[model samples]
Target: MSTKQRIAIVTGANKGVGLAAVRQLALKYPTSPLNTGGSLLIYLAARSPERGEEAVQTLLDDAQLREAGVLVQQGGSVTVKFRELDIGSAESVAALGEFLKKEHESGVDVVINNAGIALKGFDSAIVRETIRTNYHGTLDVCTTLLPLLKPSPQSRLVNVASISGMLDAYSPAIQANFHAAVNKGSIPAVTALMEKFQHSVDADRVEEAGFVKRAYGVSKAGVIAFSKVLAEQQRQDGVVVNACCPGYVATSMTEHMDRPGAITPDEGARTLVMLALQDLDGKRGEFWREEKVVEW
Candidate 1:
């Protein structure tokens, strides 16, 4: 590794916004404000190694064509390593921790928690799976990887949340619990809240609790809360964490929608891409929309 090398990892990066984040991140590192001239050691993680490698190759080809010779050369051959990571699985999350320990002695620099699912149909099975992957899965990844995210300035974690995760979407009581838990730095309370939401789903009474009826939105709300809580816990370590809306993106998740105004995958990835490269400037536990902090 070069003296200016940065280790970055992006989950669910095989396609859509996740893939775009990985691509733009490769370009961002060479010119990142946090580490000017830094070469990116990007882990383009996916649940399937085959898909991840394919995305890596596609980005590599794009870089060569788009920058001619400037990008890879200036960045000292920006490397993309693929890892099979199923964030929904605790065993898989543990495997990622071990892999990082083996790969980078200095530890990770950037993490984009982009691997999440959206369930439009609220089957009992579907809602649990949604919470498992979006809320608990994200929570597990952050907790497991915090120790590996170098305890220094300029380190970042970008959770790809949605505007739908807006706190107001929850009832005032649930919001109070979330804020109090985060303020107190109690991750267990956060976990319990997420489980409570799951139980609401089981009871088919999410609306009664003052939450969005959709499991996808509810799950994302959990992710947003977890981001804030983890940010508080990691603040002293100089690690900046943010939860940001990726915007209404035209991916498989939204392909079924008969609506207009959907942005391309690349456009949707802008907030997340920018978040990974920001200086943070003493900010933590922020919610962002298009790179600007929002009141969510």
Candidate 2:
């Protein structure tokens, strides 16, 4: 790889918003304000190898991508590769980290934690599974990849949070705990809160214990909180950490419901692409939606 080449990874990118973000990143990164005439390398990571490879082929065959000057061919300024990554699996996440470390000596420039699960029902098992994949799994990926992040203004870590994760959805006491955990800038503190939420769910006292009964909501809340704490911890390293709400998109996660106003996958991915490639003027930790920072 050229010294000027930039590398990025987008997890759970087989379809929907994740795939759209990968396409947009490849299209925009070359001419981005942060770019200075370098090749852009993006790893479209998905849990299924077959699906991941298919997504890469789809992008390569896209007429719009070709017309827009994004060439997946050899000697192109942009290259998209498929890497199997199951964020929910520690071994899978570790394998990706090791591959990057070995293949790209320059290190990784961007990481988008888009791999998450939202079950259909609410129960102790459902909540456990949701938190396991959304919160703990994401944290595992971050921890495993932290060493590979190149300390630069362009380096970014974007966590795919949701409006459902907004702190206002929780009770005041739960909100207070989140606030304190973020203030402490400690991963353990935030994790403890997530465990407490799970315990509440197990005991069938989520609302009474100051937490929302929605499993997805609580998991996303943990993601937002984790992003804040991570941002504070990585401030000195110049890695921008941010969480974003992609809006109500008509993706598989929400396909069961009829949302009239839900945006397209491309539209939902705009903010994510922006965060990955645009210069944020030194903004460190923030919750973003539609390219603007909003309260969580």
Candidate 3:
């Protein structure tokens, strides 16, 4: 079985870490039980098919890595495939679920919700859009893909998150002021955190909330909470759902920053891919870094 035949889906794979994840998964199929299935069936789900195909072509044309890039398992050989998937839109998410179900009955072995947008600068619209895509869009993808995940021998769901969302990231001033509300012994505290963030954005007072990078932080915090919720929801189904901080990868998303200690897109993708195909019985609903489980 080649990678082209085994069933896997990667969202927002047109470029960056998403594309790198597709590449690494294709390269790694030979070591998996899925490899024997011939042609690992990869649905390179992206918002735009044109952009997705271009990314694929880039992989295909890369001389040094081409041989390991697009291999898919089909008829015992690997070939990569593509589909249009826009997680930010509910209709696109639903359509993708139907498309994959109709095309592959057994369900996909892995699904990576790698589509993300950053609200890096101080802008309310950017914040709203980031929340819409990073948090809501990811949930849409998970729920839509739930049925397809049920029958797999082993299924993994990986949500790409960031450390900026961690409560620790906030300054002592803000955390101290909000600790009682946020650290209360309930999910409502977390919910309140989201509400407060949204309110800040709505009121055009993101700076007051210490959210210089407003939407991105709020969205990722949602991911941390969402992952725990998903772990609880899917615990009995034998499916693993986990979130990961891919470190600061040097990609288009971070092009505006002049930062050191940033890893390559491929490096970030490897961490995500590791979570996407990790051993379910061992760790589920956990946050991971470099393939190691980390604190929520």
Clash counts per candidate, in order, are 0, 0, 39
The best candidate by lDDT is 2
**Candidate 2 lDDT tens digits, 54-135:** 9999999887788877765834688899999998899999999999999999888999989898789899888889999999
- Candidate 1, superposed: residue stretches over 4 Å from native: 1-3, 63-65, 68-76, 256-258
Question: What's each prediction's TM-score?
Answer: 0.93, 0.97, 0.84
Which stretches of model 2 miss by more than 4 angstroms?
256-258
Q: Superposing all C-alpha atoms, what RMSD in Å does each candidate have to the true structure? A: 2.0, 1.2, 3.9
Higher-scoring candidate on lDDT, 1 or 2: 2
Which tens-of-lDDT digit does each residue in 114-188 have in candidate 3?
A: 898875575667767887788888878987887788544367888888877776666565555344543342345
lDDT of 1 by residue, 19-73 (tens): 9988787666666776666566788989998888898778767844367332463
